[model samples]
Target: MDIFDTLDDTAIEEEALMYDYLNQSARKEKIVRPRVDHFKEWDSAEFHRRLRLITESVEYLLFLVKDETETKTQRNQYISPMLQLLITLRFSATGKFLCLYL
Candidate 1:
């Protein structure tokens, strides 16, 4: 049997459509005031600062390139690892790609 077969709308009054018009719910309205989020810049700046300090601590940069290797998979060349690291940090910190710009 279909569920609609047992249903009836004849007893439903027009006022039923507007039952909440006169009565307010127990749930209250919440208004959020957004202030200048200074913490965002502080986080990004701090990350950059920390990254710079860490990099500076290392006197020399090291590379692990194979002397005779010449195959494929040059993905790192297209996207700099350092830049991807920064982007990853920002993305991870914000939990969103668009939120970083905001």
Candidate 2:
């Protein structure tokens, strides 16, 4: 008769676990993911093939947006402008959001 009656036990348990995780007292520390230097890793041909732009062109775009994209505060080391630009271009070129994380 009620909404609780519709959700199975597994669903109810999962919801409870998610609620607990969201309300945990101790904040989890930020994860420091290892960064790959794409500029160094990919050759000019490979970079163009993947991202649809040569490294030099990417650099030029980065130079334009570097001032705006840069994090003003030093509290956390944010993703670099170059990396942001690369991720965006990769998404634009391939239309795959998962590629950004990989």
Candidate 3:
């Protein structure tokens, strides 16, 4: 005569079904965020102006950080190291970042 014995099978099944429904709805609501294609859009001078780093220097930094910043997953992977580095540099240099909307 414990609490576990008092609970019915129907209650457990209902709770499980509720959780499954919530999970399904959440998966459906998943949003794909837009990313700025800065590398392709910006030229060498723009890189220098925004990040205060030359194009070659940024590429070198990307090389330095590639091992540590790389994500192992192929599906829904994190941003590239170069982009991460560029964002950091941009924030440090200009103290400005554009808002990302969902």
Candidate 4:
């Protein structure tokens, strides 16, 4: 088998493990956060603020990973944008993101 096949096998195993963990965790009692009354309204300012925070956090994480990789490689290459696009396309087609660890 080639490297891609090996990687694909590893990803499938990892996802199965993750699914098992999530299923187990779901069985436990969990506290749910209360939703606000305006949650369903698109014009709610609170919802906009929450959305902005989520976007910023995702952006920050992508930046942090790129920064760390650049520090080690010194080649100034990053995979996040391409990865994100691939993920989006995969989800659009398959209804799930493909597990790509690298």
Best model number under lDDT: 2
Off by over 4 Å in 3: 1-7, 22-28, 74-77, 98-102
Between candidates 1 and 2, the lDDT winner: 2
**Which model is ahead, 2 or 3, in terms of TM-score?**
3
On residues 69-91, what C-alpha lDDT tens digit does candidate 3 reach at each position? 88888467468777888888878
For candidate 2, write residues 30-63 as lDDT tens digits.
Answer: 7977789987899998899789998889999999
lDDT of 4 by residue, 1-102 (tens): 776666777798898999999999889685655433332443444433434333344446556565443334423333344245334444654575543435
Candidate 4 segments exceeding 4 Å error = 1-53, 68-82, 85-95, 98-102
The better-scoring model by lDDT among 1 and 3 is: 3
Task: State residue 74's C-alpha deviation in candidate 4, in Å.
Answer: 15
Q: Which RMSD values do the candidates have, in order?
A: 14.9, 9.8, 4.8, 20.4
Q: Candidate 4's error at 30, in angstroms? A: 52
* Residue 79 lDDT in candidate 3: 86
Best by TM-score: 3
lDDT of 1 by residue, 2-22 (tens): 875765775344456556655
Q: Distance from true position, residue 39, model 3, in Å?
A: 1.1
lDDT of 1: 0.44
